[model samples]
Structure formats: structure tokens, C-alpha cells
Target chain A: MKKILNSADTFVRDTMEGIEAAYGDRVGLLDGDFRVLVSRYPAPEGKVGIVTAGGSGHLPLFLGYVGQGMLDGCAVGEVFASPAAEKMADMIRACDRGAGVLCLYGNYNGDVFNFRMACEDVEFDDIETRQLLGRDDVASSPKDRADKRRGVAGLVYAFKIAGAAAERMMTLDEVTAVTARALDNIRTMGVALSPCIVPKVGQPTFTIEEGQIEIGMGIHGEAGIEVRPMMTADEIARLILETIEADMPLNAGDEVSVMINGLGGTPLEEQLIVYRSVHARLAERGVAVVMPHVGEFATSMEMAGLSVSVFKLDAELKELLRAPAATPFYTNANK
Target chain B: MKKILNSADTFVRDTMEGIEAAYGDRVGLLDGDFRVLVSRYPAPEGKVGIVTAGGSGHLPLFLGYVGQGMLDGCAVGEVFASPAAEKMADMIRACDRGAGVLCLYGNYNGDVFNFRMACEDVEFDDIETRQLLGRDDVASSPKDRADKRRGVAGLVYAFKIAGAAAERMMTLDEVTAVTARALDNIRTMGVALSPCIVPKVGQPTFTIEEGQIEIGMGIHGEAGIEVRPMMTADEIARLILETIEADMPLNAGDEVSVMINGLGGTPLEEQLIVYRSVHARLAERGVAVVMPHVGEFATSMEMAGLSVSVFKLDAELKELLRAPAATPFYTNANK
Candidate 1:
């Protein structure tokens, strides 16, 4: 493999150490575990603790979200491997304030099982906990089976809404409700031009022939809906938008937030090209984009692909999205 | 070539269109010119106009930095090709708000020539302008000949200082002085594990054998100091830091800002691993790291490599670095 890593065995630990060292003033490891990263910024008294956890390959995702006005902590696993329940429990314990804790993560099977176990573990200590699964990938399931879909870049929307709600001193139930609402409003679909390699595997997780593309692939090289000849930027944007709009049924005068996310290897220039197409199509449909984000929100290590996410917003959701946030990898307008 | 693009010929314009579509509220293309991007946030009367420009492919560098308290405007060229002098002149005319304009870019021949021409073009209009060339790549020159080196990620520091100085309403000469100081204090070096494919060329910029690295490689695949066997993370970190310290003659109690920038393809997980080593090594040398930024500040498409930039900071530089800035890609603590 042509990766610049010491060894697969130490990759995760080394990355965690680097994160702590680089952002020492803002983030640190949880007391007993280096895999659980917690914010150095104190959790406000009686504020709901917001925690997100998942595999390590997707940076600026779970751990990178831990900071003021965002996640309180995150449990990180090895590349593409879900963290153990113990690690999640540690994160929950460390992030918990008087108001209780809420856990948010993608809807992968391993993540679901581990987080469920962690919730039970934390509950044994009388720390009330709630869980919300983000399954916003419209291509993964039919509109009627949205719960079966997997989450992708749309998880950022959930993070924003839940973080803002917690920052507003919302109770655990209120935070959970708003987080679910954000998750429900989000829809994502991706097209992959190439596959990503897992360090431990020392090979690509999947393969694609040159000049072909995989539509609806997951962040970790999961199977997509179809593989076809490569399409132009405009064609790809239309396909993904039609699929999402079919599920969400966006209409004229609808206001929503748009995210054109790069899967590791895709450059921001290409992502912006995709965003331009998206914006044009949305305008044609008379849908107004309220807030637009174009960059690598979540990624598969060096995978050349991009995902488009649309979060239909309401007044409440728009306010939450607009709230100030500060993190090492992400900072919104927080003046 | 496996790329998510429409065609090489239209890539630059398409990307620009996408940027405008996504960030229409915060940025817009200069009137009568699509290559020059100016911020929607109006320049205050009598405030120095800060502008930076360079070839394309480095997203969030020239164009992404144009927003509040960062850059007033930027001239973008085709991938790895400098924008025409006419575009730069147009940007200068538009950004100038009666307090003159300050031009900052890397120490590249084409950039230097075009910007010089632009200054002359606007001279007829009586708009005073000052230029600062960022030549901080230590490996590109000996310590005594630092001015001969090329610029890399260190240019970002120059932008921050000049942007903040202008935001504080510094005169054209004062902003130019601080920017020059920032450029002088900055040093950078990079290693490339693999080559990146230029969209127009449809081929890798250069090639390297598997398990090998090119140390001190340029952002556009220019020749590096040496080619060596791939080393462990600690070994690589030591080599880079030692080289930088040797050039700067760093000593105990020295304070610096560190930036571990990923060349597009390197994942954040791996970047953080490198950052961990950088932090530890700097600590071992008794050098204090003031503000640490660990992410993809500058990139060469999806090149699988990284660069380290160290900026020795004074009190004035530190305050400017800490000053609030907001852009689509970056936002600093403002409150």
C-alpha cells in the first residue's frame, strides 16, 4: 500500500495522540481511555451532554465534532471498525453533566449494537441516556423504509441541531426530539469514482473499473445501488437530486441547507462543481438553499467520490443550524 | 485517469461556477471577470484592501480565504496556471476602497510577473499598491538565501497577518510590513509519498516507487531535496523538524505556530498522526507551540502527501493570528 503510516496496529492510537497534542487547549482524551476524546471546555451545568461515536477513517466526523456548541465527546474506533461498547461507555460517563446524555451516530449495525450496549452500561450507573440513529441515505432504502437507510454526510445536520439545542440548555428529551427531527429532514446520496484502502487490510475495500462509477456507495465502501459508466457533473447531480427529491418531495418555495461533501480523495474544486449543479437544479425546482457547505465533511480514506446532502429546514431547524459552533476541524459563524 | 470531473478544458470555470453558486451570499465573481472573486462583505472606507491569488487546484487558499477579516479579494487561474495580469488588475481595481491595495501571493515566477503587471495596470488609476512575496519553503533554499526559496503553506500565515492588519485599519505600508514580517518568519517543508494527477494532463505530475517518499517536494510536484526510503512516522517527523530548526536556529523558549497541512489525498487520521509527532518533537526541543492548525490548509489536488509549516510569532503576530476571521472554509474565535 502507498499509505504514509507507521503500521496498521498503531495508526488509531497515534492519530488520537496527535489530535490531543495538536488541540491540547481545546480537546483531550477521556480519563481512562485514549479512544474516547472529550472537550476540554467544561460542560455547562444542567446542559444535555451531546456525544457521537463511530469508526476512525472519517475525520471531522465523530471526534472532530467535540468542542463548544457541538459534541461534548466522541468514541473513536480503528479505521472503519466500530468502537467497543466499553469505549462508548467511557465517553458517555465523561461527557455526562447534570442534565443527562444523548448519543448520536450513523445507523451501521456494529455501531448500533455497540452504542446500545453502552447506553445500558451507563444506565446501570443511573445516568439517564437517550439514543438517535441517523439513517439519511435515501438510496439505501425506499421512502417508506427510511429507517433502514444508512447515514452519510447528513449526520452533520444532526450534530448541528443537537449541539445547538444542548447549547440552549435544552433537556435530554428536547435535544433528542430536535435531533430526530434533523435526522428526518436530511437526505444523502453519493457517487464513488474509486475505492478506499483500509490500513489493516493493505488493499482497497472494493474495486471499480476505470471510467465507471458506483452510485449510492457508503462511506466505508459498502455496496451501492448500481455501477455504470461515468457520467458528467450535471448528470450525476441530477441523478442524486432526483432520487433525494423523490424521497423528500421538495417543492417550490422550499428552503433547505445543502452540503456537497468530498469523499477523501475528491478535491474541493470538484466538490464545488457538483455543488454548482445542485444549486442550479434546486433553483430550477424553485427550492431555495438557505445554508450551503462544500468540503470534506466525512470521508473514506482517499476514496475519490462525492456525496450530496439536502436538509429541508423549518424555522426552528434554521435557527439551530445558524447557531455558533467552534471545533478544531469545524467552526461556524460564532461571533 | 479516475477523476470525478466533466472535462479537463472546463474544469476551472466549472469549479468557479460551483464556488459562486454555493457561497453566493458570502462571495461573488468580480464584475466583468469570472476569474476574480471578491467578498460580498464590503470593504470599509479607508480600510486597506488585502488580496491574494495563485494558480488553481489549491482550494481554500486563494479563493476560500476571501471573506470577513481574511482576504478582500482573490484572483484564480486555471489548475496550476497563473491567472492573467488583466484579471489581477481587475481584482485590484474592485477591491481598492480608497486606502490602497496590498497584494500577497507565493514567490512564483508567473505570479510575481502577473502581479507586477497588475500593479502597473492600476498605477494609471493612481491606486497605490504594495506586494509581499512568501518564500518560506526552507528546503528550497539555504538559510542565508531564504529569499530564493519557494512559498508553500506558509503563505496562509502571511494572509492571516495582512488580513488582520488591514481589518484593524492599518495603512497600506503597515499591512505590507506586517505581511512581510510574517513571510520572513515562516518556514515550510513537505514530503510526497505518491504523485497527484493534474486534471488537464490526465496523468500524475510525477511518479515514485511504492514504499518511497520524496522529501521537500513542491506543491506542484517540483523536485525535492532528496528521495529516500519511507520512514516511520517518528523518523519522518524528526527529519522535517530538525531541518526546519537547523535553518531557523530555534532555541529553548521560542514560540511558534504549527500547521500540519495535508496534500489532498492524505486522510485527517494520518495528518493527526504526523501532528502528534510534530508536537512531541517541538516539546522535546523546548519550543512552545502557540496556535496549532492541523488540517488541509493548502493542497495539490489529491496528492497523497503532507507539508509542515512553522511560523515564529511575535506579540503583534500572535494577536493578529488570534483575531476573528470568517470564510466558507475557515472561521476563527471572534468573541
Candidate 2:
């Protein structure tokens, strides 16, 4: 393996230690569990607490979003592995501010099982928490089975709207409602040119032959809908948009927020290329892009791929999306 | 040759088109020169124009900084090549708003030569401008010959400070003076686990044997002072700090801003690991870390390595460093 790491055995702990050291002023470890990272800026009393938890390989996903206008805490698991239920419960306890907590995460089986258990554990403590699953990957399921789809880069939108709602002191139910609405409007699909290596594995989670690409691969190297010879950026953008539009059915005059996310090894220059095609396709259909984000938002370890996410916006959702946010990996001008 | 690109000849233009398409609201191309990207938000009538430019491949460097509280314009070049003098002059013209422009970039020979020519060209139009060369790579030169050092991640510091100075309506000379101060206080060093592939070349610029690393390597695969067996993150961090301290002589109670920049392919998890060591080393020396940034700031086209930059700060520099800034790849809370 050509990775620059100390050892597979200590990878997770070392990384967490590093995270805490680097962001000491903004974040802190849970009192008893280091895996549960909490924001140092305490949430306002009576404000809903926002928490997300999942595997660790995707930086700025679960932990990187914990800040003033985003997540309150996150339970980090091993790379591509779900965190334990106990750890998730600890994260909930750390962030609960008496107004109740909202648990949000991707719809992976292991993540669902563990977060559900954590919700139950938190309920036992009378924390009064709610849950919302992100199933935004249109290629993972048919339109009728949207709830079965996996979450991809669209999770960042959920974090933004829901966190803004919570920051505005919305009730837990209101926060959950806004979060679900964000998820409903979001649709994401990805194309992978190469695979990512989990540190512990010391090898690629999966492989792709040279000059070939996999459409709709999950972040953890999950099976995609199809594999084909590599195509131009324009062609790939069309394929991803068509798949998402078929499921969500965007229309003329529709206003939407777009994200072109790089899956680790892909450079920002190429991500912009993909975004160019996406913008052109959307404009051709008379769909107006209100807010556009182009960069590595969610990623596999070092996978060379890109994902496109479209979040159809309403007045309420647009306001929440434009709200100010500050995090290590993401920040927006309130204007 | 495992790249997701269309053609080498059209790569730079295609990427620039994509950038304009994605960020049309905040940025736009110069009227007569597509290679020059200028901010859509107009600068104040007498505000100094902050401009940066260099070769392509380093996304979020030249073009990404062209937004509020940052760069006013950027001239772009082909992959790993200096932009033409004519293009640089066009960028200067687009950003000049009565107040003079400040031209800042790394101390590269080609860039130096071309930018000098561009300066002469812009002078014909009676635009007052100043130049500040960044030379922060300590490994590139001895302490007595610091001007010979190559600029790496430290260039980002120069951008942040000078951009803030310009935004605060500092005079052209004032912005240039602060930028030069920032460059003097900064030092950087990097290690490369592997080389980057130039898209046009379709091959790695250089190679490293498995289980080995090159310390103090340049961003463009330039030769380093030494190659050695890969070591643990702690050992590597110690070596880097020792070398930087030997050259710059960091002292106790010194306030510094630290940036752990991923060259390209290094994941955020690993970058955090490196940051952890950097924080600990500074703390051990009783040096105060004022602002810490860890991520892919200035990249080298998906190169599998990272660079460490430390900028010692004074009261005046600290205020500018903490000033509000919004860019595609970076944002500050402005607290």
C-alpha cells in the first residue's frame, strides 16, 4: 500500500486525536468517549440539538459539520464501518440541550441499525429525540422505493437546512420536518473512475479497469447500476442528471441548488468541468440554478470519482440553504 | 493514464468554462480574455485590487480567491505553465478600479519573468501596481538566502493577508507592505509519497518506490534534499518541525498561524494526523497557534503528498489574518 499512515491498527484513534488537536477551539471530544465529537460552542438552551453519525472515511461529512450553524455532535466510526450504538447514544447525550435532539444520517443498513438503537437508548433517558434517514441516491432505488436509496453528497444539504432550522430554535418536530423536506428534494448520483482504499484494508475496496467507469457507486464502493467505457464529461453529466431527473422529475422554471462533489482523488478543476455540463443541461431544460457548490464535499478515502446532487428548492428551503454556516470544511456568506 | 478527461489540448479552457458556469454569480471572465477570471462584485472606487496568478492545476489558488475580501482577479495559465504576459496584463486591467493593483504569486522563474513583462505593459496604461514575491519553502534555500526559496502553501497566507488589506481599503503600498511582511514571517516544508500526473502528459511527473518518501519535495515534483524509508506520522512531523525551526528559529510565546495543506491525493483524515503533530510540536515549544487551517488549499494535481506552512504573526498581522474572507475553497467566521 502506498498510503502515508502509521499503522492500520491505530488509524482511527490517531486520526481522531489529530482532529481534536487541530480543531481544539471549535470542537471537543465527548466526556467519556473519544469517538463522539461535540461542538465546543454550546447550543442555545431550548434549541433542538442536531447530530449525525456514520463511518469515518468521509471527512466534513459527520464530524466536520459540527459547529454553530450545523451539527451539534457526531459519532465517528472506523473507516467505512458504522459506529457502535453506544457511541451514538453518547453523542446524543453530549448534544442534547433540553429541547430534544434530531438524529440524521445516511440510510446504510449498519448505520440505520445503530442509530435506531441509539435513539431508543436516548429515549430511555427522556431526551425526546427524532430520526430522519437520508435516501438521496436516485440510482440506488426506483422512484417508488426512494426510501431504500443510499445517501450521497445530498446529505450536506440536509445538514444545512436542518441545522439552520435547529439554530433558529425550532422545535424538534419542526427541525425534523424541514430536514425530511430537504431530503425529499435532494437527488444524487456518482461516477467512479477508480476505487478508494480503506486504511485497515490496505487495498482498494473495489476496482475499476482502466478506461472504464462505474455509474452510481456508493461512497463505500457499493455496487453501481452499471459499468461502461469512460465517456466525456458532458456525457457523464447527462447520464447522472437523467437518472436523477427520472426519479425526481424536475421541470422548466424549477429553481434548484446544485452540488458537483469530488470523490477524494478527483481534482477541483475536473469537478468544475462536470459542473459546467450540469449547469448547461439544467439551463437547456429551463431549470434555474440558484446556488451552486463545486468541490470535494463528500468523498471516499482517495477514490477518483465525482457525484452530482440537485436539491429542488422552495422559498422556505432556499432561505434555510442561504443561512450562514461555519465549519472546518464548509462556510457560506450569509448574503 | 487513468484520468477522466476529454483531451489535453482543450483541458484548460474546458476547466475554465466549467468554473465560469458554476460560479457565474460570484465570478466572471475578463471581457476580452477568457483566461483572466475577475470577481463579479465590484471593488470600492479607491480600493487596491488584489490579484494572483500562476499555472493551472492549483485550483482555489488563483481563481478561487477571486471573491469578496480576497483576490479581485486572477490570470490562469496552462497546466504547469506560466500564463502569458498579455493575459496577466488583461487581468490587471479588469481589476484596476482607480486604486492600483497588487500582483502576488510564488517565486517561480517563468512566473517572475512573465509577470515582470506584464507589469511593464500595465504601466503604459498608467496603472500604479506593486509586486510581492512569495518565497516560503525553507527547504528550497538556506536561511541567509531566503529570497531563493520556493513558495508552496505559504502563498495562501500572503493571499489572505493582502486580500484582507485590500478589502479594508488599504493603499496599494500599504497592502504590498503587509504582504511582504507576511512572506517574510512564513516558512514551509513538504513531503511527497508519490508524484502527480500532469493531465496533458498522461503520466506521473516522477516516481517513488513503495515504502519510501521524499522529504522537502517541491509542489511540481522537484527534487528534495533527501529520500528515506516511510516513518510514522509523529516521526515525520518531528523532522519537518526541526528543519523549519532550524531555518526560521521559532521562539516561545510566538504567535503563529499553521496550515496543513494536502498536496492533492492525501485524505483529510491523514492531513489531520499531520496537523495533530504540528500542533503538539508548537505547543511543546510554547509557541501559540493563533489560527489553524488543515485541508487541501494549494494542490498539485492529485499528488499524493502534503505540505506544512507556519506563519509567525504580530498584532497587525493577526488582525488581518482574522479578517472576514469568503472564497470558493476557504471561508472565515470573521469573529
* Candidate lDDT (C-alpha), each: 0.88, 0.86
Off by over 4 Å in 1: none
Q: What is the TM-score of each candidate against the true structure?
A: 0.98, 0.97
Best by lDDT: 1
Off by over 4 Å in 2: none
- State the lDDT of candidate 1 residue by residue for A144-196, as single tens digits: 87789998899988998999999999899999998998888999999999898
lDDT of 1 at A59: 82
CAPRI grade of model 2: medium
Q: Per-residue lDDT for A1-335 in model 2, tens only?
A: 76766788877777888877877678878874668888887677898999998998888677888887888999988898899999999888878889899998899999899998998998888999898988999888888877788988899999999989998999999999989988989999999988888887787767899889998898989989999998988899999999888888999999999998888898888888888888999999999998798888888978889899999999999999999888766776622
Residues B17-71, candidate 1: write the lDDT tens digits: 8888878778889873669899988778999999988999987677888988889
lDDT of 1 at A24: 70
Model 2 interface RMSD over true interface Cα atoms: 2.1
Sorted into a CAPRI-style docking class, model 1 comes out as medium
